[model samples]
Target: MSEDIEIAGEPSPPPAVKAKSRARTPTEIRLLARGHTKAALKVLVGLMRNDEATPAVRLSAANAILDRGWGKSAQPIESGEEGLETVHRVERIIVRPEDAVEGDADPKA
Candidate 1:
């Protein structure tokens, strides 16, 4: 009887799978830099032409331009406490007024 029981099929899997899924590619990096320079130039021209536009609007437009030019990445959050606590920070650089226009001398000069 004991030998008969040992001849049974392999044991079944546990109720749950403990292993995590593999990470997949989020987004294509090649498309990010495409047309970026042209889009930035256009945004700059728009800002120069529309002095009445608010700074916030201009900045939003700039961001949009960059986002469109460079496709977004798919950043997936892992299933863990670290994922919940993760934070992303973005930094922006603004061209000073004196430095914006061509052939303009430094304000301090």
Candidate 2:
């Protein structure tokens, strides 16, 4: 979306866009992000190897690189009690932006 700015009493309208943009799928988003993975890893590696970085910051950078390469370690959930039952409750909510706002959404737009 383009932003329109109003200078003083004059209004500046942005150029009209002909094509509409649809939301990208998860795969598409991942592919787009993956394109920057090499650069991201390079930055991480630099941070991890930089002597000027704090030990904690360096450790964090190393961890990020390790996570990308080997994936995160599986975490085990613990009840932290002796023979105690840990019951989890799950709830799902769906929200529509058009319905959430009053008279803000246009079906044609």
Q: Per-prediction TM-score, please? A: 0.27, 0.55
lDDT for each residue of candidate 1 in 1-109, tens digit (9 for 90 to 100): 5643645487755688688977645454445655486776787669745769988877777766666669765788776665367569999998887666877776676
Candidate 2 per-residue lDDT over residues 5-95, each given as its tens digit: 5567776667898998999999999999999988998999999999999999999999998898999999977878878877799999987
Candidate 1, residue 41: the lDDT equals 73
| Highest-TM-score candidate | 2
Residue 85 of model 1, lDDT score: 71
Q: Which candidate has the top score in lDDT?
A: 2
| lDDT minimum window of 10 residues, candidate 2 | 1-10
